[model samples]
Target: MTAKLWIDSDVCMSSGRCVADLPRVFRFDDEEIAELVPDADIDAEFDAHRDLLVAAVRNCPAGAIHLQEDGVEVEA
Candidate 1:
């Protein structure tokens, strides 16, 4: 199974790296903070763009992005 990803907005620094890294999944909300699109299929996105998502998590200065699979948090 793919890892389902999400962002912790409170921890986000509006770096935009996630947006730059994965447009299909991450986007800037009204507040300009990086967040997942409302209708995004986290599992599918993760499956397709695992590399981009990994880059996002690695590039996010605030370390706000995270993933889960089967209710267990993913760390990568």
Candidate 2:
């Protein structure tokens, strides 16, 4: 019913692209890892900045970003 983004902790290389791209939706912890806010709406959480999310995933380098919709994984 809605869109979502998942970050693979293991694959994340701490590039901080997610946080820089979608600061409202993602945050960097002390360890420089990206953390997604729980229960946060994909639209609202990222301030309707879908491009930023897309860019983050595309430039992830680590291939840790996963986009999904309604419980189904969606290709970037």
Query: For candidate 1, which ten residues in a row score worst on lDDT?
Result: 67-76
Candidate 2's TM-score reads: 0.75
Give me the candidate number with maximum lDDT.
1
How do the residues 13-76 of candidate 2 rate in per-residue lDDT, one tens digit apiece? 9987777766777887678888886656785644566667767777888988987656777555
lDDT of 2 at 23: 70
TM-score of each: 0.83, 0.75
Model 1 segments more than 4 A misplaced: 70-72
